[model samples]
Target: MSGNTKIDVSYVAELARLELAPEEKVKLQEDMEEILGYIELLEKLDVKDIVPTAHAAPLRNIWREDKAGTPPGKDIMLENAPGLIDDELIKVPQVLPGEGMS
Candidate 1:
């Protein structure tokens, strides 16, 4: 990586579906070049003896004993629902746009 690094800021912006002003393009190009330069520096590090790990520190799952909880009564459940059909079933938005109709 060098000061004369060339990056197609317009191409990158297009790929990201972003419209950048001329000044913004220049700023983004410089930022992207800096980031790539940093990555290049990282690639030069000696990691042969270093162990690859998902995290920097050891991780363990905390366990807790499962306990049965009382379910809400039908009346309370109905009251909390946004909408209900015939006061018996929960009404939700149709998933498919124009299917499942005669």
Candidate 2:
């Protein structure tokens, strides 16, 4: 498969809201072509009847029951907190509205 058939870097840059210089565009085009060539080579490999495996080593389901365990009281939970006001609220730097990134 041709690189042109696989990817259009200029179109991708436009979607990403990025501006690339002429040299950068050329470099990216070559890199994309090499990547597509590797993918085409992989497509030619035979893997019929192979059982899909998520990991190489012996695998087991690593999970615990979802039933609730012992719960910490509110006072115990907030005992080591850096900033707390009363039993329910955490004090943080007040951020002024409309003063941050869009």
Candidate 3:
């Protein structure tokens, strides 16, 4: 890893929308260099014939029996509701436009 191979800390800060202090910039630069070195080491590994496995152990379906079941009636379902205006509506927190919820 050459010292001349610059890691643009300012560009990183801008992308993350972070306001890094001058001292923090120096620390982050060192950390980024170390991370790049580790990635470079990983790039040199040989795994030509290795098949990718999703889990460490052998996996099984472990699924439950799928069958149709009766659902509770509307009155029983709505019994625990704090604020139900009618049979059709359930009152909830007042949501505002442009608040990221919509």
Clashes of each: 0, 0, 0
Q: Candidate 2's residue-wise lDDT over 1-98, tens digit each?
A: 54447677898999999999989988998898888888887666678898989899997878887898788888898888888877678777667777
Tens digit per residue, CA lDDT, model 3, 22-56: 99999999999888866676556687898999998
- C-alpha RMSD between model 3 and the true structure: 8.3
Show model 1 residue runs off by greater than 4 Å: 1-22, 68-102
By lDDT, the best candidate is 1
- Model 2 / residue 6 / CA error / Å: 2.4
Ranking by TM-score: 2, 3, 1
* Deviation of model 2 at 55, angstroms: 2.3
Compute each candidate's TM-score over C-alphas. Answer: 0.39, 0.40, 0.40
Which regions of candidate 3 fall more than 4 Å away from where they truly are? 1-5, 46-102
Ten contiguous residues minimizing lDDT sum, candidate 1: 1-10
User: Per-residue error at 77 for model 3, in Å?
Assistant: 23
Q: Write down the lDDT of every candidate, Cα atoms only.
A: 0.82, 0.81, 0.81
